[model samples]
Target: MEQLLTVKKGNSRTTKIDVEGVYYRDLNAQLRELSSKGIQNVQLLNVYGQRYIGTNLSQPMEIEISGTPGNDLGFLMNGSKITVYGNAQDGCGNTMDDGNIVIHGHAGDILGMSARGGKIFVRDDVGYRAGIHMKEYQDKKPIIVIGGTTQDFVGEYMGGGILIILGLNLSEEKTYRAKFVGTGMHGGVIYLRGKVEQYQLGKEVGIAELEEKDYRVLHDNVNEFASYFNLEPNKILEHQFIKLFPRWLRPYGRLYTY
Candidate 1:
């Protein structure tokens, strides 16, 4: 008898994992047979508020959840890789189409909502529209990396990929609690660190500083989000990173069509 399952506590919607004691007797079909048996490091003894924990996996496994995981945790995922220690709710990786989801603690609200591909790494501090309406196809570019400090519309209406928000220490109090950032953004790219004054972004979008090929893709995505949440990647490269796109919108002489 090489099977150990335990999810004996309540209120979860779409679970499945068909085997290995099967959640000690059908805990939503053992979370859908561990999302169709690509179980790589499954150790979730007693997860409580489970809702779509690793939904619709394709392959590539790695799920290690503990507690407090509800509300679209990897909803519509393609490929597979999930890691959550605690504190996750509301669209953690909803609409994901690739792999990689890591939330050590703290996350709620549209955290990578409408993702069209993969990559979501959040160490802490997240809530409100964190990468809301994120999208990207063609190259399938989807990436959201948040270390700390996020609230309000982090990247609303982003029609592409690459959104990074890092605050870490979180309060020199200049600007962290973002508001109305990138409203109706026609494309992608949103990276914020600190010192935004009163932080009110929208109106198409236009902000700069941080080139050199976007500092090598934000220093390789903040050094892989501080090496997967361990921190101290030169104090996140000593701050100062704010870049949003989509500004020069001069399509044609649109008084009337030609």
Candidate 2:
């Protein structure tokens, strides 16, 4: 049994939910029910470590989460927009097909793992293997922007899409801390705004000069990210950026016996 309460706000039809002592399943059930009834905006309060907060939701709604959410926050989500005012746990956008996830604080490991389409913006640091195995097809391409530095294996096995690491909090001379970056990445590009030593990159990845199209992509995404966190986009874009891409389409193709 779960105890939850909902209150309707004036005019806007926004529903506020108090999820104290409510099970994750029950909470998600209520969310689905509300969305099915054409409720487009919801605010969840007292959400302490509830896993799968917005999993597999395809409706075009806005969900505001106030407390720290547990793992798999928006797994396989489509069309819904989720804004987390607090920190998020591991696998934030696992295989998400569409929508936006804006995190005000840090995020855990494997953020945006294998997301096919959508955007994820983190205002602070992220843990290991952020953006691992992400891919894109046709008009659907995922994008992830991290404001702070990350741990090891960032963008490991990424097949497509865009990844941006702003490194805003780091000193000008300090190199990025992540190692084995873009390991086994075959497609897509990664934009890093800080120093990275040669040893930090995987052998399969190579650095390239930014082109006009690349600049456009960075400008749009960085501007959006800066606007979300109330930072100046110009100051963030003033620094140099390095592009990382795979040297070969299949780095391990020779390893397999075909």
Candidate 3:
């Protein structure tokens, strides 16, 4: 039978669990050991707001979380797949290196901050700073997709990586009014599927009509997101997308001296 362990409430708010006797117990050490031993498909029960649920898994293992998970749910995850049935708190997939994190519900702030690789899909709305400080590396690019409206600073200081904000819940009129959407962004792409009037792009970046190449990338990302959340792919492609990129302003040049 599969292992199960209930954490004992202690003086500290954090709960600690130790596993034993079962295939996949809740013990911190054993879980890692089993994963290291090439075990796959671990099931977790009653996981209420637990932090670091499947962090840093060296091997490719599937973890199904039943309840809501706390902040940093998949901190620095290497090569594991985590599916959260409920909502997730702040920093849901902070600094993830590889693999995928699928949240059936909403997510909190800084969802994928500084993530180097991997993909994060949120079926619902998300809080502020969803993809702040995200950078891209050769052969390994990070991508974040939000189904509903996102809060301010959606793609702040993003050196690389692809960020797609689909305003499914809001009207087309007010979808692209996020504050500081691409401030200090130097690389990668930001595709917004709505009528964006504010146009608060950073001095280093410029906005233009998305070309066929850009739409192909956006379509791939959004299609994967739709499949993960069981949405209609064709409908998501109906809207137009605006592509944002760095404007190539020379730093420490005449602009700053003035």
Candidate 4:
């Protein structure tokens, strides 16, 4: 285990770890150690299916991952940036507080469940419940943007945050297939660039016209999303978008109130 990871010698600010065949616990311990040492940048190579790759990372550092990571990639993270070169498994950013996660490929289920703050950008599709239960805490707000479509219940029970689905991979004539979107949602917003039928939405959701403030949010976030994947922000913003808002606060409160 000790020989598998090599620390880059003579570089005080930056270090590289060859995390090939190392256990997840050991890898994380090394990460915590390096972060405490004030390492500004860390690169992980050959990281195949390592779960909890960036858990409990509170420092403002950068991580470059070469291979696919396992579930809960950034669980409970704070104030860091992680860029994945390959696909990530389920629960990519589960319950993260503050940070940025950039995935170059697709991700599995529950992409950003219960995230309080941070931004997650996936260049490809994600599995079921992509942004479930994201909430705002005081001044913190979470944001998630997907370049492709997601599976069912994309934002189920959302409390607060911003979610954008560009559907850049889908044909213009096709509609997003995620059904029951925003089911049980009481807060937050979703912006979609492609088509979705009214019947596909949950009873609690309603499509609203995009206001000026909405456009500004789209322009800024889409610009950053575009910059990550080498896309044209103007071309993306040229397309018409639909805004989905929760019809009211606590959409299901009546069921429990009386």
TM-score per model over all chains: 0.35, 0.95, 0.85, 0.94
In model 3, what lDDT does residue 73 have?
75
Looking at model 3, residue 200 earns an lDDT score of 62
For model 4, how does the per-residue alpha-carbon lDDT over 1-258 read when each residue is reduced to its tens digit?
A: 342443555664557778889899999888888788788688888998989987875466788899998899999888789999999899998998889999999999999999999999999999999899999977899999999999999999999999999999888567688999989888999999966899889899999879999999999999999999999999999998999999999676678844
lDDT, candidate 2, 1-258, per-residue tens: 332444566654677888877889988988888888888888888899999878755467789999998999999988789999999999999999999999999999999999999999999999999999999999999999999999999999999999999999899567587899998899888999966888999899999879999999999999999999999999999899999999999899899885
lDDT value, residue 206 of candidate 4 = 95
Instruction: Check candidate 2 and list the clashing pairs.
Output: none
Off by over 4 Å in 2: 1-12
Candidate 1 per-residue lDDT, tens place, 12-121, comes to 22222323332323543454565566445455645667677777655556677766667888788876778887888888888888888988888888987889989998
lDDT of 3 by residue, 1-258 (tens): 335443333431212232223222244455587677766666666666667767856676777777777788778888688888888899987988887899999999999899889999998899988888888889789998888877787787887899888888877355555777777777788888775554666666678899989888988999999998889988988977777776663422555643
**Clash totals for all candidate models:** 11, 0, 2, 0
Q: Point out the higher-scoring one by lDDT: 1 or 2.
A: 2
What's the residue-level lDDT of 188 in candidate 2? Answer: 84
Number of the top lDDT candidate: 2
When 1 and 2 are scored with TM-score, the better candidate is 2
Candidate 2 Cα RMSD after full superposition onto the native fold (Å): 2.0
Residue 192 lDDT, candidate 4, scale 0-100: 95
Worst 10 residues of 3 by lDDT: 12-21
Query: Which regions of candidate 1 fall more than 4 Å away from where they truly are?
Result: 11-32, 36-63, 66-76, 79-81, 86-100, 105-121, 124-145, 148-159, 170-186, 195-243, 246-258
Candidate 1 least-lDDT 10 residues: 12-21
lDDT of each: 0.74, 0.91, 0.76, 0.90
